[model samples]
Target: MDTVIRMNRRQILTGLASGSVVAFAPGCVENPTLGRSQLILVSEEQIAQLSAQAWQQSLQRERVSRDPALNAQLQRVGRRIAQASGLGYDWEFVVFDSDQENAWVLPGGKVAFYRGIMETMENDDQVATVMGHEAAHLAGRHAAERASQQQAAGIGLGLAAVALDAGDVENTAQWAAILGAGVTFGVLLPYSRRHELEADRFGVDYMVRAGYDPREALDFWTSKAAQRTGRPSVPEFASTHPSDETRIAALREYLVARNYI
Candidate 1:
């Protein structure tokens, strides 16, 4: 009975994988902002619904700061970056009352920044640096792209598992786990790094267009790099984000190429 169940599972996975690939192939669409094609299997309406749910959950889960000053700063910086993006999202910015040095943007222009990060900004240009980066993520449609990639990878993995099972392979579970890790470190992580780099480059462009000095982006990232000294380092291949050194260098190179430095 167990063997029959296993065989059925393998057959189901195999069929799903084959059908998914054919169905999702046409999802490749050109993104004018990034000047590249992106796999966007999920529709904008679907992403927006998910984003709204996530935003509401975040508001319920995290203590939102009521500080008028912090809220004003975020709104000021966020609005400018949103306008500069030209994506026409109904933008909303909120300050989470956390001491974490982090900020993120959801699809449909829901932006959140931690008070810790906001307090560290020395000027509005520094604020713009972070705002522009979050806005760039929205402009790049990274959330949707990432979802599409994961869906595709799951299909590929399903097919691989079926092949292993059909071959009567030993240690099939171990092989499947290894393949999963390979997909993470090889495909997903690399694309995430690429997304970060893209955001950095275009974020600087948005900053410039919004009348903020792009040089501050250099200083901001360099400071972030300095703060990482003496910390345990994850290899660039295994991490979703580029190393601080790599990001700083890339930003500098881009700024110089665009004559922003």
Candidate 2:
């Protein structure tokens, strides 16, 4: 986690009132994989607990595929990335019987790959592209960081409410509007972009370490980019992710800089 703790208006006001100064959350830690510090209000225990519940829920909700080949491929590729990451997570990968081009990994190395995404992958290398990226998200501790940031933002909004109350501003409608804008622009959008890019860069590193060609990563994204040709796209500033072009360009630069090409 990031080292310095910067309190928002709510913490500042509370400290002044109570004559005490401290961080809103005390669980900041440095992550070796990300090469930076993070504000992790949510602990590993909490994430594991929640992930266990979520994994169970997913098992009940989604249709799990029992194809032997699919299961074998997921286990093989996922294990390679897991080994490269050097994290001793009890990894389990499943293929869901759905047409959604999506895959996600929970904190405890619980992964779900939709049949749609699997069908789109041309080779095991492409599967490794998705696997490495999702694994990098876990290694980077992006989930806990996002949760902490949102908690801080919520505290800021609470403080703003207090300030409004002190000033006798009774317009509840106006307060809601301001809070919505603060959360959308301040907390959610920016961090999402950063997380995606970080995952992309570190994902390629994992791919190379796992003995997968980095070029396949670029190819996978290029194909996905083509798929988005006729669809609408949110502007980069307001979006939760970098545009495909931006993401692909960054991947190319990383591959070149690291000599992974």
Candidate 3:
């Protein structure tokens, strides 16, 4: 009698490693109906788990803003944009009491906005642009994409060794704090340049669909880059985001070529 354990696709390609497994490099998922994206590997269930945990920490650990009307405004704006998304996932909006100008959307329509960014917009359109960008990220499954990349990285590392054992990566701490995602935005993620650009482009259109002018997205990014003033932001190499200047330029090129302005 032979006891043969069948390895899943991920285990097969990844061969064997220490504490890990990987699947074959899959092709990009394309949604022709909506021209959006869908998950090809990592399940939405996993995203929900990650999102739930991260959101709990955000509410408990992060400072929350107290302005009543501001929170209301965020909800209103987020709703309008989310409606345009046509995504049927669970949605949420949260305002954090912070001075840094940042906003992000997690998978499953879990959205958050920092009050600091509220100060940057001159009108609803600008804010809408930002919202659209964040929305684009979720709609395109950017978080899952990042997660997939991280899986690949971990699998690659595992495959480098012998058959995977759970203890191989037990003690190694990552060093992507400067900009990479081991701890921050791309936690356990390693994205390529292509994904970021796609997100940016898709964001512009989402803004348009949400009835906001897409051109301002370009302006918004340019203004942000200009305001950097040599301040240390996370480096692009390790960060999931592109450089400020690069992002601004890409937005410009995208807007001009598409006549979205």
Worst 10 residues of 3 by lDDT: 160-169
27-102 in candidate 2: lDDT tens per residue? Answer: 7788888888888775555445545555666777778998888888988999999899887899988898877677
Ranking by lDDT: 1, 2, 3
lDDT of 3 by residue, 93-196 (tens): 77878665666666677666667777777777777777776676676666566555555545321111111111110111122422234434444323434455
**lDDT value for candidate 2?**
0.69
Candidates in order: C-alpha RMSD to true structure: 10.4, 10.7, 10.7
lDDT of 1 by residue, 175-210 (tens): 224346777776766776788789899999999999
| Total residue pair clashes for candidate 2 | 6
Off by over 4 Å in 3: 1-28, 31-39, 155-175, 178-192, 232-235
| CA lDDT, every model vs. true structure | 0.70, 0.69, 0.58
Model 3 residue-pair collision total: 14
Superposed by TM-score, candidate 3 places the C-alpha of residue 195 at a distance from the truth, in angstroms, of 3.0
The lowest-lDDT stretch of 10 consecutive residues in candidate 2 is 162-171
Candidate 2: give the clashing pairs: 1-29, 1-30, 1-37, 1-38, 2-37, 2-38
Ranking by TM-score: 1, 2, 3
In model 1, the runs with Cα more than 4 Å from the true position are 1-26, 155-180
